[model samples]
Target: MIRQTGATLTGSREKVLQAAAEMIAEDMGTNLSVRAVAARAGVSTGSLRFHFPTQRELREAVLRRIYGRLVSDDPILDRSVPPRDRLVSCLRQVLAPAGVGAEARRTWTRAYEAFLVPEPTEQVRDAYLAYEREGLRRMEYWLTVLADEGALPRGDHTRAVHFLRTVLNGLSLERAMPADDQILKTETETLFTAVDAVLGPATT
Candidate 1:
């Protein structure tokens, strides 16, 4: 067990968030606190505060850390690629298991469970809301870009974004539930097929 008294303070922001995320990802955020997170990050509480001033801020940061790949990285949005292809890449990452990369799907499973509790702290509830909001914003941004390129059929961007997200979430749950590999593959194809039906093929 690492002692807090021996805590190190040279941690980077990304390192601190990564440590906090791992801690929560393993134990469902019950171990989330400045002292605990700092200890895991090898930093003192004061140092953690230097990076994130409030506990709420720290929790929010952890949420972002978990979803950062979806929020920050886009490998297929280049103009050189077909807009449909780019959109498919975006959807794959957005719906990929948190476990698909370095994370465990259980991490996100706990998050979703938390969202359904009878009651939650305002901060916790807001964290969930902010997460979904950020995802939708990213989806909308991509859809708008595709629309501007005449890749998608003319339609309501808001409705399109919402519908696509709903479909993605449902399909994600199928695999996230530990569905059979073949079922997962089939559902994934269904997802792309639905996308094509809604967005139509890329235009000239």
Candidate 2:
């Protein structure tokens, strides 16, 4: 058995996840070696490998952890909030640029990029599919709640969800590029305006 070092031996699974997340955020998509992660976490390589034997396993764990942080358990699907407003909030949270700090942005960018890569392994593929499905499910949930509350002008929840997901994905890619603040703001506003034109305005 691999011996854990320092206080990590007593640390929960969440601690391992935090260490991995910090590493990914700091490094972006580069140098995600098990040895590196072990060193960063103050644990033996064997211990890290014992917990996650394969690279894919560790990547999937990190993906799930980040998803959990991004997606709320009690999502604001309340019918009281107009569907458009709810959708905007959801998209903004999903696509907001990493942040002011280089580390924060780099971490988020790495995590997001990892999710986009098409892994050949069956387990990796399954995990990716699960992530995609969960995203769609969230969109569907928002659309359904809004439709029920008479927020959507037309209630094709499935179609609306699909369209919104596509748009969000496209916008996310665009926002990932290096652009001036004014250009970024204009592009984001234009995209949101287009979405609003289709989805209708959010009522205060």
Candidate 3:
């Protein structure tokens, strides 16, 4: 009986975290009080506090959950596919919306906006730095995979990673805007051309 009760408690905590993540993603700077999260999760504020004692703790938890989801669902690290295809898949995943929901867009926009801000707690800055490092690491991994498959040259993989990261960052910023299809197409093509110059032919 005690074990079953504990399981239920765990599930409730998860619900709170999920609710907080959805809310934070929608509005990073928006008020995410314990009461607000508890209300959204259909739990009492006391229960939410039991799971996350402070607002900062709850916000950090939400950010960690978001990062975990990104890592798990990332298409770039798939090893079964050809390197070029895997790279393309990874690029597309980053460029395209993760989902078609308004909540998803809001969450993504909020996260991006947070990263842009320079004034935040040390913890927040560290979290942003961690995210940036992970991005670079992923780029390096992709470059190594491509080189192993003879898709890219076997020299200076780090430089290639840096270039790709720069291009990706620029593309991401541009795509985040409320642009039309033609503009998106043109920007994407321009980015692709630059990528091809560094990585060789992107086509298989």
Identify the candidate with maximal lDDT: 1
> For residues 76-133, could you state the per-residue lDDT of candidate 2 as single tens digits?
5654665555566766766554443354456446665655564455644554564566
Off by over 4 Å in 2: 1-68, 71-82, 97-119, 153-156, 201-204
Give each prediction's root-mean-square deviation over alpha carbons: 6.2, 6.5, 6.0
Of 1 and 3, the candidate ranking higher by lDDT: 1
**C-alpha lDDT of candidate 2 relative to the true structure:** 0.63
Those runs of model 1 whose alpha carbons end farther than 4 Å from true positions after fitting are: 1-10, 28-31, 55-57, 69-73, 98-113, 147-158, 176-182, 202-204
Q: Model 2 residue 126 lDDT?
A: 58
Taken over the whole model, the C-alpha lDDT of each candidate is 0.68, 0.63, 0.67
Ranking by TM-score: 1, 3, 2
Worst 10 residues of 3 by lDDT: 95-104
List of clashing residue pairs for candidate 3: 25-107
Q: Which model is ahead, 1 or 3, in terms of TM-score?
A: 1
**Candidate 3 lDDT for residue 44:** 84
List, residue by residue over 1-204, the lDDT tens digit for candidate 1.
543333333345667888877875665525367777878877667778887898667776677666665547674468897776677778888766554322435655677666665268775566566567767877788887877777875556888888888987776666556554486468668767767766774332
